[model samples]
Structures are given as C-alpha cells and as structure tokens.
Target: MATVELRFSAQPEHVRTARLVAAAVARRAGVDEAVLDEVRLAVGEACSRAVGLHRSHGIDAPVHVVLTEEEKLFSIEVGDEVPGSGGGASAVPGVRASGADDGDDGAEDEMGLAVISGLVDDVEVTSGESGGVIRMSWPTTPATVLP
Candidate 1:
C-alpha cells in the first residue's frame, strides 16, 4: 500500500486543494472516471466539514488529508485538531449539525455528510487521539492484464 498525505490550515479555500489531490491520487490508483468524480466530491465534503468544525471552535491547527492506495481499495481520511473542550459544533454558515433529529438543517440540500455518504462506498466519522476524522474508501478497479 502507498499513502499520500497533505496538511494545511483549516481554511475554507484549502478544501479545493484537498479535492484536487484526492482526484490525482485516485487517478494514479487506476480508479475509473465515474468513481473518480465520486472521490473528488466526497473528499471535498469531508475536508469542508473538518475545516468548518475547526474554525467554529476557534482552533488554529491544520487539517490533515491522507489518501491510501491498496491492492483492492483506495481510502481517504480527513482530520482536524480536537477542540479544547473535547467537542465542537460546526458554525460554518452552510454546514448543518450532524445528527438524525437535527431537522432538515439543509444538510441534505447542501453537499454535507449526506452527500458524501452517497458518493463514497464507505464513510465513517470518529474521534481519535489526534482529533475528529472522516474516513472514506472505495473499491479499486481490477487491474487489466495484457494478453
């Protein structure tokens, strides 16, 4: 397996950089064009959410995006520094709180977690020693053998 990691300030503009890097890595891993699009969007959403959460909590740490290429799958993890209080709510203008009973909150309307869940094969959110993380993975296309 190979891994590519990028770390940048938790700023909104950096989200685009994360998406581009994810697409480049997916392409390098022989991901299909259709799935490439999904990877791009999913990475963007994950990065945006992390950045938003960090900013909301007034955290000045950088966000980390890591892409891993394996034999049969490609995985991406976006993480942000843990807030001082151990938890922080998103205050980004368009992002909605992640919860089932939060009422619409426009989460479905916008490219939030809901959209990421649909675009990627697997999506997971968790908090760890470093911070909160959004993990996404997709199956890779089988390598074609030349006759």
Candidate 2:
C-alpha cells in the first residue's frame, strides 16, 4: 500500500490543487481512465465541503486529503476540523436539518453530498466532535503480466 497526504489552509482556491493531485495519484494507481474525471469531481466537492466547514466554524485548521493506493483499490479521504459537524442530519459534515442555523440553508451541502454519492460507488461519511471525514474509493485495474 502507498499513501499521499496533503494539508492546505482552509481556502477555496486550494481545492483545485487537491483535485489535481487526487486525479494524478488515481491515474498512477491504475484507476480506470474514464473514472478520472469522477475522482476529480468527487475530491473537489469533498475538499470544498471541508474548506467551507472550517471557514464557517471559524476553525483555522488545515483541510486534510489522504490518498491511498492498494493492490486493487484507490481511496481518498477528505477531513475537516469543525466541532459537532457530524453528530446528526446527513452523512456529510456540513449538512444539517433543512433551514438550520448560521443563516445559511443546508441545501448546498446536501447537493454536494448527492454529487459525491453519484460519482463514487464506495463511500463512507462520518463525523464527531473531533471533526469529520469523507472517504471515497474506486476499484483499480490490475496490472497485466507481459510475457
């Protein structure tokens, strides 16, 4: 197994960098060529979600993106440092019951989650006081033996 870890300030612009890195790593890990765009989009959404949570909650902790490559799988984990972000409503961290506090609707968060679910076949979302993590994985093609 191999891993690549990245931490960046809670800034929206940095999400693009995370997505690019994820796609590059996924490609090298033998993820299907057609799935590269899905990986990029899912990573972008997850990173953006983390960045938004950090900003909204006044938490300066950097967003975390961990990419792991195993024999037949490639996984990426996006985490945020927002307290109580995962206690309830949705699987995603920022999600809340419709029309919750912060004077902001949770629709965007839900939409982001929906997009991620649509893109990734294997996904796990969890949160607690410590923070939250969205782990998404894709199957990797096995290396063919050349005679």
Candidate 3:
C-alpha cells in the first residue's frame, strides 16, 4: 500500500486544503471521476469534525489525515487528538465524542459524521484515550500512481 499523510493545526481554514489534497490524491488513485466530489465532501466533513474537536477540547496536537492507496481501494482516515471515553462511548454512531463537553458541538459533530456517512460507502469510526479516527474507503479503477 502507498500512503500520504497530512498534519495541520486545528483551524477551519485548513480544512479546504485537506479536501483539495484528498481529491487530487484520490483522483490519482483511480477513484471514479463521478465520485471525486463525494470524496472531497467526505474529507471535508471528516477534517472539519476533527478541527472542531481539537479546538473545543483545547488540544494543541494537529489533525491527522492519512490517505492510502491499495491494490483496489483508496482509504482516507481523519484523526483528532481529543481524548475519548475510557469505555469508547463515541464509537457508537450518532453519539457524542467520548470525553467531549462541547454540548452544541457534539450535535454538530454527529451531523458531520452523518454527512460523511452519506458520501462514503465504507467508513469506520473509532475513539480511545489517544484520539478518534474516521476512516473512509472507496473502490479504485486499477490505475495507481507511480513513484
């Protein structure tokens, strides 16, 4: 598998860059042309969610975006440094971030994930003491970018 990793401060403005990079990489990875818009929207939702979580919780660590190109799949993972509930409550769909106390933001966060869910067919969300990641994957067209 080939991978591209990006780190950015928890800022709203940075989200657009992440979305653009994700789309370019996904295009090179052979994600269907028609689905490029979905990829961009999904990445934006994921990154925006991460940024909000970081800022609300006073976490200084950067947001993480990992794009991986595999034999037949392209997957993007967006992660946040916000701590999770020791029990992983955030793992539940539409639930609040594990340890998040931003009441209204929690609702917005859930809505963001919902949007991402609608855009990407394959998605995995996980959280723990370390952080949370939203992993979205799509099928490729057998055209992988060369080094």
Candidate 4:
C-alpha cells in the first residue's frame, strides 16, 4: 500500500486540486476507468464538504487530505478544523457523500453524502476533536474484466 498526504487551505478552489490529487492516486493504483471516475467524484465531494464546513476559531484552516492505495482499492481521508476552534458543536461533522446504493446520478448531485456513498463501495464518516473525517474507498477492478 502507498500513501500520499496533502495539507491545503479549505478554500473553494482547493476542492478541484484535492480531486486531482485523488485521481492521481487512483491512476497509480491501476484503477479501472469506471471505478476511477467514481473514486474521483467521491473524494472530491468529501474534501469539498470538509473545506466548506471547516471552522477554526472563527478562521478557516487548511484541510488535510490523505490518499491511500492498496492493490485495487483506493481510500481518501478528509479532515479539517472547525472554525469555532474546538467545541461540541464544532465537532459536528459534515456529510460524507450522497447515499449508498442510490445509482441515480442526479441524486448524487443533490445529496452530498449520497453521492460519495453511491460512488464508493465503502465509506466511513467520523468526527474529530476539532472537525471530522470522511473515508471513502472503491474497488479498482480492471475494465477488461466482467462484473
């Protein structure tokens, strides 16, 4: 397994950068086209959510993005500090993706958590002391293989 760590501002534009980073990891893992596309979308949504809800003593802090790849599986972890500094409410986590098993692409665009869950085979949403983390994973099956 290989890991790539990134620390960047939770800015709006950084969302795209985070997605690109995740996509590169997918490519390194040899993920298939379909799975890679899903991974890219899921990770992008996860990071964007983290950045959007980020709170840091009334100041926006950088979001930490961790990308991991093991064999045909890729995982993305997005974490950030709540702007309120660190409090119970600040600990309130944001949504992960759209929803699981909801193949409706439109739903994905509508729901944040649903989109991530729909794209990834596995997803874990956890809260941190200051912010939260979203972990998303998808199988990198080769396109040449049959489902």
Candidate 5:
C-alpha cells in the first residue's frame, strides 16, 4: 500500500504545502509526469475550496490530506473541521460557491472545480457530519488521459 499524509493550515499560503504533498505522492506512485501535474492542480483547487469553507468559530483547524494508491486508482481525501467542532449543527464548507465558473475576471483567469471535475475520472464532495471527509479519485490507467 502506498499512502502519504500531510497537515497544513487553512490559510492560502498553506495551500502550496498541500500541492507539494500531492505532487510528491503522485511521483512516488509512479504516475506519469503529465498526469502527476494534473493531480497536483486538482488537489490544490479542492483543498483551497476546503479552506475557504472551513468554519471560523474560534476553532483552529488544520487541513488533513490523505493520498492512497490502490491497484487501479489513486484516491485523495481532504478533510476540514466541521461546524461546532464536529458536533451540534452541521456546517458544510462553502468553497463550491466560489467556483471559477462564475462570469468574472478572476473566474476567467483561473481553473476552478469544474475544470477539476473534467480532468479527473471521479470527484466527490462530502461535508463533515460528525466530522466527515471530502474525497476525489482518478484512475491510474494511462488511457484515462488520452485525447
């Protein structure tokens, strides 16, 4: 089994750490260089969304990243603190609302979750319920990247 774990702040600067961690994992998994870059980009976009949506109710929460390489696919799970610290009312992160699909200058310049969905074979978003996790995965098969 091949897996990598990383922890970083929810701040923007820390997103780079997440990206680096992802790239490292992909490389270690023997993923194609081109496919590796795509994974890194998708990881950054997803983690950034998670950071933006984390609840800021006086609780300092670090983003958690887990990359697991299965025989057929690579899975990435990014998790954040839930509302009320995984208790009381459920709070979902709002990063999807800030997607790059909006008709704005910033949106036009950056690739958002929509692009992420396009690049990967599978993408999933799950709000922390009693502290749940959001995960994304893609097939490692070379044909997945073919034109």
Candidate 6:
C-alpha cells in the first residue's frame, strides 16, 4: 500500500487545498474518472465540516488528511481536534449525535452524511487519540490495477 498524508490549518481556504491533494492522490491511484470526481467532492465536504467545527469551538489545530492506496481499495481519512469534547460530538448540522439518548427527536437531516455515504463504498466516523475522524473508502476496479 502507498499512503499520502496532508496536514493544514482548519481554515475555509485550506479545504480547497485538501480537495486538490485528494484528487491528485486518487488520480495517481488509478481511480476511475467518475469516482475521482466523487472523491474530490467528498474530501471537500469532510474538510469543510472539520474547519467549521474547529472555528465554532475556537480550536486552533491542523486538519489531517491521509489517503491510502491498497491493492483493492482507496481510502481517505480526514481528522481534526474538537475542542472541550472528546472528539465525539457531532459538528455537522444535520448529523445525529453518535450515541444520543435524547428522546426529543431524531429529525436531523444528515444531508452531509448522506452525500458522503452516496459517494463512497464505506464510511466510518469515530473519536480517537488523535481526534474526530471521518474515514471513507472505495473499492478499486480492475482497471485501477497498478501497472
């Protein structure tokens, strides 16, 4: 497997840089053109979400992106530190709390999650020693085989 990692301040402008780097890595991994587009958009959305969370919480930390190319899959992980929380709080407006017990309502729209889910084959969200993580992966096609 080959991996590429990028780290930058959680600023709005930096989201575009993340997208570009993700696209370049996906392209180098032989991802399909259609899938490449999806990867770019997903990376942008993930980075944007992280940036918003950091800004809202007044946390000045870097957002980290890691792209890995394996024999059968291409994966991307976007992570950032969430302030005051153990990185488990939901930052996206419409996402349901990871493990909420509130009986009020589960009416959150989760459009961002929906979009990410639609684009990638698999997605996992978690809080870890590093921070909040959004990991997405797509299966590589036979055409994506390395020469």
lDDT winner among the candidates? 2
Q: Is candidate 1 or candidate 3 better by TM-score?
A: 3
Per residue, candidate 3 scores C-alpha lDDT tens digits across 10-76 of 9889999999999999998899999999999999988887887777667888999999998889999
Looking at candidate 3, the ten consecutive residues that score lowest on lDDT are 85-94
- The local distance difference test score of each candidate is 0.74, 0.83, 0.81, 0.65, 0.65, 0.73
Please say which candidate is ahead in lDDT: 3 or 5.
3
State which candidate has the highest TM-score.
2
Candidate 5 regions off by >4 Å? 55-58, 83-111, 141-147
Q: Per-residue CA lDDT of candidate 2, range 1-147, in tens?
A: 438999999998899999999999999889999999999999998887788777766788899999999869999998888765643235445444333477476666667778999988899988877898999999999866779
TM-score of 6: 0.75
Superior by TM-score: candidate 3 or candidate 6: 3
TM-score of each: 0.77, 0.84, 0.82, 0.70, 0.69, 0.75
What is candidate 4's lDDT per residue for 1-147, written digit by digit as tens? 338998887676878888888888777666776676777778787776665555223445678888887767777787756533122222335422223355453233236666776767688776656666777776666545548
How do the candidates rank by lDDT, highest first? Answer: 2, 3, 1, 6, 4, 5
Off by over 4 Å in 4: 55-57, 83-110, 141-147
Model 2 superposed RMSD (Cα):
3.9
- If ranked by TM-score, best first, what sequence of candidates would result? 2, 3, 1, 6, 4, 5
lDDT of 5 by residue, 1-147 (tens): 438888787787888888988888777665777788888888887777556555333336777889998876788987766542221122323222333356353332124556677787777755544443557776665435437
Residue 30 local lDDT, model 2: 91
Kindly report which residue stretches of model 6 are placed more than 4 angstroms away from their true locations once superposed. Answer: 83-109, 142-147
What range of 10 consecutive residues in model 6 has the weakest lDDT sum? Answer: 83-92
Among all windows of ten consecutive residues in candidate 1, which has the lowest summed lDDT? Answer: 83-92
**What is the C-alpha lDDT profile of model 6 across 1-147, one tens digit per residue?**
438999899778888899999999888777887888899989887787677667656678888899999887889998878632222334434444322369343332144556777877788877755567889887776553458
Native-to-model Cα distance after best TM-score fit, residue 22 in candidate 2, in Å? 0.2
